[model samples]
Target: MKHAPDFLSQEHDPRDPNPWLAMYLDRSTPIDDEVKRAWLADSSSRSRQVILPFVRPFARTLIVLFQVLKFVTPRKLAFSRTLHRLLAWGMQNFIRPEANWLILRHFHVGSQVLAFIGANSPAPVETSPLTPQRIGDVRDDLFLVHDLNLYNFVIRLNRALHAAGRELEHVAEPDFSMIAQPGLRLEDMPDGRFNFLDLQSSIELFTPIYQLLLTDDDFWRATNSLQLDETIGLYAATILDARSHLVLLNNRHPLVPMSTLRAGFRLTLHGLSTEMLHKVLFDRRAAQEAAQAALFAAGG
Candidate 1:
C-alpha cells in the first residue's frame, strides 16, 4: 500500500518561500563555520557578485578563442587583436546603466568554469582552462579575450563593496520552484560519457542543484523517466547545504524561453562527466602541434 507522500509533497505556505530548499536543508549538515567566517572577512563576496554577470561575455570570447586556437597555425592566437574588438562591443552594447547595478547585485552561476569561479567554488585555478602559454590569448582582449579581467574585476569590486560595507550572507529558503534537476540516466549507455567538459567540471554529479530550479511544466516534460528528477532533487539538497548562494536557474537570456531552462537543466545534469571535464579544461591545445608532429614522425 502507498503511504501518503512525504511531508515535503504536502502543500505549504507560499510565503514560506523556499520549502523545497528547506526540506533539502533539513536533510543535510551545516557548512563549516570557518568557511563562512572567512567569507565574511573577505571583500571578495561583493566583487564576486559584481563580476559574475559579466562572465558570459568573457565565456563567449573564450569559447571563440578556444575554437580559434584549435585551428590556427603555429597554435598561437592573435587574441590581443580580437580582444580589443570584444571590449568595445561589450562596453557599448552589453554593459549598461541598468545592467550595471543588476549585475552587481546578484551572484552569477552559468554552465561554464567561469560560473564556478564566480560562485567562489573551492577550486578555481585547478578547474580553469587557463595556462601560461595560452594565457596570452586571454590578455589580448579586455572584453573579448580569454584573460583575467573577470578575476581582476572581482578583486576591485570587492574593494569597492567592502568600502560600502556590504557582505553576502549565504541564503536559504522554502521553495523548489527555481532549482535545477539531474539529466543523466543509467540507460543512456555508451553515449552517456560523450560530453567531456561536463564530466570534468562535475556537472553530472551536480544535477540536483539544477533540478531544484525546474518548474511544474518542466517536471512534466519527462516522458521517459522521473528517476533522474528525484535523484537530482536529492543531489541538489546535498550541494545546497554546502553552498547556499548557488541559486538554481540557468542564466535566463532574452530570446530563450521556459523550455530552454529545461534543456539547460538536462545539459547540466544528464550530459556531464568528471573525465570529460578534466580533458576539456586541462587538455592544452598549444602543445597539440608538437605532440602531433612527434607522433607523425614516429609512425607515418
Candidate 2:
C-alpha cells in the first residue's frame, strides 16, 4: 500500500474534521519557526519594521495611484508593461537573501501540497505543470496564478466525482447548476484574457504594507491558514460556470473579500521572495534532476 506523505501522516485533528482540509491547513514544518525567527531578526527585516509606519502611507498611496493608472491608461500605450518591469527590477535589486529563501520555500511547500493531494485524492486532480519559466513568467502574479490553478483543479475534481455518481465524504459539493444550463459552454471566453498586470501591480504594491501592518505571529498565522481554501474552491466553480455578467454581479459570500485580501497579502509576499531567490539559486538542470528524484520517491 502507498504510504501517506510524512506531513499528512499525522493523526487528523478534530478542529479540522476533513482530512484533505486538514492536510491543506497544516502548512508548517518543524523548522518553520526557526527560519521565521531568523527572517525576523535579519537586519533588513528589523529596519523595515522600524520604518514601516513611515512607509505604510506611501505604499497605500502608490497602490491607489497604480489602480487609477490601470483604469485610465489605454492598452495601446502598453504603459503597464513598463511599470511591471520597473517594479520587477526594484524587487530583484532589493530584499535580503534570507527573506528571499523563506518566500521561495513557501511556494515550494505549496507545490508539494498540491502534489500530495494529486497523489492521494480519490478524485482526479490536475495541477498546473511546474516549470521554472512558468514560475518566472508569472512574476508578481505568482500567488494569483497558483491560486487559480488550485481552484480550477478542485473544480475539475468535483465535476469528475459528480459525473461518476460518487462524492468525497465530508467535502462540500460545489454547485454546478450554472454550468449545466443550456446556452452556456465552458470554452466560451466572453471577456478577453484576464489583466494579469493589474494583479501583479496590486500585489507588488500591497504586500510590503501588509508585512508591516501584521505582527510577526499574525503574518505567520495567515501564511499557514487555510480558512479560505474551500471558499476559493467554491468560487472557482461558480466563476467557471457563470456567464461574464452574472459573475460580475454575483453576490459574494461574507468571507470572499477577506479571503481575497489574505491571499494577496500572503501569496504576494512569498511569491516575490521566491522570484528573488530564483535569480541566484535556480539551476535548470539541477531542478530537473531533483524533480525526477521526487517523482521516483513518490512512486510516480
Candidate 3:
C-alpha cells in the first residue's frame, strides 16, 4: 500500500484542511474551526490517561469476581464469594453516599441528564403478563452521537445536585425554560408530585435555533460566573431534585455510565479541555464546521 509518506502535509490541497492529521499528531493548524474539532475529538486519549490510573483496583476486583464466578465447585460457596466480591465492588463504586457527593461537585452539566424526569421520578412499572415478549422493536440502538454528549452533561448534573442535598422538586426545569423562558409545568410521579415538562428527543432537535439561544449575551453572562465543574454539579443536582418534572423520550439513553454512578458518585468529565469548554461555551465550532463543509460542497 502506497500511503503518503507525509500524510500530514496533504492539506496542500487547500480545499480540505485535513483536520485529522492535526487530530492524531497534535500538530498546530491555522484554521480555528479545524483546531477545535481536533481537540474535542482527541479527548478519548486524554480520558484514558486520566481514568486508567484510577481503575486498576476496581479491575482487579472484577478479575477476582470472574474467577470465582467461573470455577468454584460448590454452588453455595460460589454464590457466597461472588456476592461478597460484587457487594464490595458496589460499595466502593456507587453505593456509597459520598461518591454521589463527588459526582455533583465535579462533573454535572445542564442540557443532558435532566430531561428524563416525569412528574416524579417514575417508578419501575411492571410490564403486563399479557404483553408479548417481543413487544418492543429492537434496532441498532445508535442515536446521533451529538445528542449523547449533551445528554450526558445533563445526567451528571442531576446526580450531582441530588448529592448536594436538593430535591428534584426544588430545582429542575426544561432546557426550553432556560432557552425559551416558559413557566413550570407541574405533574404527578411515582414518588411524588412536582414541576415537570415532556421534552423532545435530541438536543439537535433544536440545533437550528439552539445556536441563536446560546448566542444570547445575557445567557452567557448568567452562566459565566460559575466554574465549569460547579455549574455541572448544580445542573445535575437541580434535575435530580426535580426528577418528577422531566419527560425523557428515550429511556435507554443513560444519564451517567452505570459503572460511574455505581462507583459512588464519581464522574469522568470527558470531551475537550476545561479551557476550551469555557471559550466555546459561548461559541459553536461544530455547527460552524458543518456549515462550512456544506457551503464548500455546494460551491457557495
Candidate 4:
C-alpha cells in the first residue's frame, strides 16, 4: 500500500486543517501505516522539537510517581473510587478549558468515524459508545498529565492554523456552564444515575480536552508506539478490549475496582484510535476479491 504524504510537507486543505483527520478519513492506505507516518511526521515537526524538551522531565517524574502510587494504593473498589473522584475533582478545577475541549473533541470525532463505518460496512460494527458522563468521569492522573503536555502543542497548532487562514471544521464549541454547576460533587454521583441530561452537560465540559489531545503529535506517537516491542496493534487492542469488558462487567455487577474503571476509560480512547484504523483498513470486499483471485489462480 502507498504511504500517506508527509503531514508537515503536504499542503493542508483550509477546510481540514488537522492532518490527523485526513489520515483517519483516508481509505487508500492502511490506517496503521497512516498513523505510523503521522507519528513520524509529528515527531520530526518543529512543534514537537520545541515542546518535548520542556515536557520530558515532567513526564518522567510523573511516570515514577505513578509507579509508586500503584504500589501503595489498595486495589479495593471503594478506596480506588474515592481516589479517582478526588483526581477528577482536581482535574475539573485545574486543567485549562481549552485543554478540556481538545480532549472531548477527539471522542466526538471518534463517534463520527464509527457512524461513518457503520453506514458503509456490510456487517454491523460493535462500538462502546462515548458519552459525556463517560468522558467527565475520567480519573487517570497519568492521562491528564500527558494531556497537559499535549495541550501546549495543540494551542500552538491552532494558532498556526488560524494564521494560515485554515481552521478545523466540524468541531463544535464546548459550553462549560452545563457541567460546572454550583456545589457539583463528581465523587458523590452514583453509578447508573447519570441520564441524558448529565451526558449533555458532561460533553459540554470535556470536549476541549479531546480537541487538544487529538491535535498533538506526541499523543499519536505515544499511542502508536505503546507495546512497540510486541505485535503492533493486536496487543493494544486486546488490552483495551479487556479493560472495556471489565467496565461492562462492572456496569452489570458493580464489583470491579475503580482502577479498572479508570483504566477502562483511558483504554476507550486508545480503542477508538484502534477501531478507526481497523474500520478503514479492513475492506471486506477487497479481501473477498483477493481471495477469489487467489482461488482462481490455484484452480488453473
Candidate 5:
C-alpha cells in the first residue's frame, strides 16, 4: 500500500511547520560524547577537497555559455536523441556495462554541476493574493524550465527501466500546475547536428560519486521481475519529496497543483541526458577524425 512519507507523520502537531531539510541527515546514526570525540579527532587535519572551490565560478561561466549555445542551435538537441539511442544498441549487442557507465558518468557530472552551481535557490514565495506588485510573482517562466527538466528526466528513467526489462507503469503528478506544456518527445526529433563547440569542455566527473549513483544494482533487481506498483511508488515518492521541499522553502501551502512538478521532473531528466550524450558523442567524433587524419598522413 502506498503511504505518505514518514517525515510528514513525524510532525507532532498537524498545524506546526518543519522549516529545515532533515531528510539528507542520517537520523539513525546518533553521536554520543565518545563518538563525537572520535569523529572530530581528525578535524584539525584539513584537506583541499572539502572546500567547494573558487573554480566553481569558472565552471558556472562555461555552463551558461554552453546553455545559451545549445538553446540557439536546436539541431544539437535533436542529434542528442539519435546518439542516446546507441545505449539501447549497446545493450542489445552485450556491451551494456561500458555504455551504462558512460551514460551514468556523463549524467551524474552534468546534473551535479547544474544542481550545485547552475540553479538558483527556490524563488521567493508569493504569499499575498494577486496584487499589481505581486503580478510578476507567479513565475510561469521559471516553472516552464522546471517542467521541461522533469519531463526529460521521466523519459530517460523509463528508458533505463526498459533496458532492464521493466517500465514505469505510472507517472506521478506534483502540486503545481504549469501554464506551458511541452509538445515534443524524444521520438519527435530527427537525426541531425549543430555546432560542436558547446561540448568542447568535458564535464568533470568524480568516479567514486558517480559509481555510488549508478543504478546497476537496481537494474539487476529489475531483471528478477519487479512489479508495476514498485515503479509507481518510486515516482510517487519523488513527487512528494519535491513538493515537501517547496513547501518548506515557501513556508506556506503552495497554490500550484501537483501535476506540474511531476511532469517537469520527467521532462528535464530526458533533456539533461540528451545534452550529456551529445557532448560525449561530439568528443568521440573529434578523436576519430584526428586519428584518421594522422593515419592518412603516415600513409602519404
Candidate 6:
C-alpha cells in the first residue's frame, strides 16, 4: 500500500499489460519476465480510465441491464464455451443465402455489430477459399479474413478507392492481393496468444476495449498494418464495405448506444487512467482500497 503514493513516480507500478509491450518480453530473463508480468498486472488495474470516458454517457443504462439480465445472463451460462460454439455454429451454418454478394453483405459485412463478440481472425493467409473451377480466373478467387485488422484496413482503403471512382480489385493483383504478410497468429500470439477472450460466452465479462474498436482509429491502425512479409495479411474489400454494412444492419446507427439497453452495455467496459491503472496493478491492496472507498462513499 505504501509502495507508490504518487502515480507519476517511477516507484509507482501499474499492473496493466500494455498490448504493445506485452508483444515483447517473451525472450527476457525469468526475473525480467516477472518484472514485465507485474507491469502488465499494474496496467490492467487502471483500465477503467481508458474505458470509462467513452461509456460514461451510458453508465446508468448499463446498471439497468445488469439488474434486468441478472436472471437471464447468469455468469455460468454466459461464459459457457459449449453454448457459444453452438451459437456461432448455428449462425454460420443455419443461416441461408448461398449467393456471393448476399453472403458477403449479410454475414461478412453485416452482423459485424458482433465484432466485439470476437471476429475470429480471418481464414489463414495461405489458404484461398475459391478453387479454380469455382471462380475460374485469378481475379475471381475468394479471400477469407484471417486478420481482422488488415481486413478492416482493406475495408477503409476500399472506401477511399471507391470514393475516387477506383476499386481494389481492378487496381492490381499479385502486388496488392493480400492485405499484409501473415504475422503472429492471434491463437499463437506472443504473450500466449492473448487476443482478449477466445470467444463470446453467454455470460462473459464485459470489456470496453471491444466497444471502442468501433470508434478508435488508432486502435484500428495499430492492429491492421502488415507484418514483415507485407503482403500476407492484406486483402481487398471489393464486394462489400465493413462499416457501411454495419450501419445498414443497425438501421444506420453505429455504436451510438441508442437505447437504454445499448447504453447499459456500454457501461460494462470499465477502464482506468494510466496512473490509476498502474497504481492499483502494483498495490497488493488495490481491491481493499476500492472497497474502503466504496464504503466511505456509502456513509460507512
**Candidate 6 local distance difference test against the native:** 0.27
Better of 4 and 6 by TM-score: 4
TM-score to native of every candidate shown: 0.20, 0.45, 0.20, 0.30, 0.21, 0.20
Question: Model 2 over residues 76-136: C-alpha lDDT tens digits?
Answer: 3422333334434433444443433344344554454344344334564666633322213
- The residue-by-residue lDDT of candidate 1 on 133-234, one tens digit each, is 221222343222122333343454456457767543322431222212122222221212221121212221222222222222222232112223232222
Query: How accurate locally is residue 104 in candidate 4, as Cα lDDT from 0 to 100?
Result: 44
User: Candidate 3, which segments miss by more than 4 Å at Cα?
Assistant: 1-107, 110-175, 179-300
Instruction: Please estimate how well model 1 matches the true structure, expressed as its whole-model Cα lDDT.
Output: 0.29
Q: Could you give the candidate ranking by lDDT, starting with the highest?
A: 2, 4, 1, 3, 5, 6
Candidate 5 clash figure, as a count? 31
What is the C-alpha lDDT profile of model 6 across 140-186, one tens digit per residue?
21221323443554455446556667433322211222221112111
Model 6 stretches astray by more than 4 angstroms: 1-181, 185-198, 202-204, 208-300
Residues 136-168, model 4: lDDT tens digits: 555543343433433333344446556767533
Task: State, as a TM-score between 0 and 1, how close model 6 is to the true structure.
Answer: 0.20
Candidate 1: clashing residue pairs, number:
31
Alpha carbon lDDT of each predicted model: 0.29, 0.39, 0.28, 0.36, 0.28, 0.27
lDDT of 3 at 165: 58
Question: Once superposed on the true structure, which residue ranges of model 2 sit more than 4 Å away at CA?
Answer: 1-34, 42-44, 74-88, 129-144, 169-227, 230-255, 259-300
Q: Runs in model 5 with CA error above 4 Å?
A: 1-55, 75-300
Q: If both were scored by TM-score, which would come out higher, candidate 2 or candidate 5? A: 2
Q: Against the true structure, what is every candidate's RMSD?
A: 24.3, 17.0, 22.5, 19.7, 25.3, 24.6
The lDDT, on a scale of 0 to 1, for candidate 5 is 0.28
